[model samples]
Target: MSALETVRIREAGATLAAEAARFSGYGWMRGTSGNLSLVLDRDPLVLAVTASGLDKSELTDTDIVLIDGDGVSIDGDDPRPPSAEAGLHAHIAARTGAGAVFHVHAFDAVIAGHRWPGGIELRDMEMLKGIGHSAHDETVWIPVIENDQDMTVEADHFDRVYVPATAEVPEVPVLIVANHGMYAWGADAAEARRHLEIAEWLVRFTVATR
Candidate 1:
């Protein structure tokens, strides 16, 4: 595989598309439901996200759309458009220096959403180190907020409550939208995808044990 072939895994180009494809294979993003994004820069962050509602499996570089600090597109004209949750990605990248954010609808995660009243607590899991902190002695709180139709409102809620609450601990790099899906991020796309995968595994393990 050449550099291009390796970079474009399966049918992906942008890091977001690659992660989306991986998550789709894991059955987290099905039926064109979930979305993903990655930041281009950090000193002055900019984003290139998948065009909204496109099937994650068929994603290619052509579908990746760039957005400014305000979450407005600053790239080519692909008629489809960015995901409805683009603002949420922009918010996290701007505020937290996150290079990538992966959102998905995993089966076990959805089940765990109903199981936990507030948020799911991931404690004593060795995989917790993949995120950021090395906390084998504490509970990593992954907040689960109710999903809503208003993307901007939900984004604000995430910023105001969810972001602050989770940022209190570095290891907790995930946020669950009750009954909807999950979001995970990191300094870059690879790490972010790892975070998503780890969170998915932890949730699945918790559900199976219970």
Candidate 2:
């Protein structure tokens, strides 16, 4: 299913929350350091996203909130809000039809971004094909954007810059947030989780074998 594949806000919200909750166990997104999202519908425009600053490890269904493309909360009576990077997830879903976007601050991904500061180049890895790339020779250019406090500005810049830069390579589903985390997207929440694992593996391998 594509990101545009619509579903009820409740279903979408629950799935995103569960995925975020599970990712916490990997010890990468430990202590609420990541966010998750899935597009709910396209007509009225909505997304189910993880609430901001919540501990992912012990998340509940209440932690999810439906938001518009601009990150406006639409559903859930909860007073808390979605993740700050929620806008970036919406921007990606709008552009890529990615059913889910999972982001986490894995040590290797973050360290690689800081060491490279521009991007991380992955090559000659057989698992590269898992993301649909045809050859190990294919280099995935993970955009490394400088982390910002203003999620709005960062989201705008992501669309204006990162999207355009990687438009020619849609198969690459992961992008690095400098000194922050890796943003991984896929056709659904399960796919997103798998890609996040693969992305983390790729970066970890790159760092280890360097």
| Candidate that would win on TM-score | 2
Global fold similarity of model 1 (TM-score): 0.84
Per-residue accuracy of model 2 over 130-186 as CA lDDT, tens digit each:
666645556676667888878777776566445432545655788888888899888
- Model 1 segments more than 4 A misplaced: 1-12, 42-44, 163-171
Error of 2 at 137 (Å): 3.0
Worst 10 residues of 1 by lDDT: 5-14
Give each model's whole-structure lDDT: 0.75, 0.77
Give lDDT tens digits, candidate 1, residues 63-171: 7776777667765554557788887888877766777888899988888888994888778888777766554887777777778777677777677545443555654
Worst 10 residues of 2 by lDDT: 1-10
Per-prediction TM-score to the true structure, in the order listed = 0.84, 0.87
Cα error of candidate 2 at position 69, Å: 0.7
Clashing pairs in 1: none
Write down the lDDT that model 2 would get.
Answer: 0.77
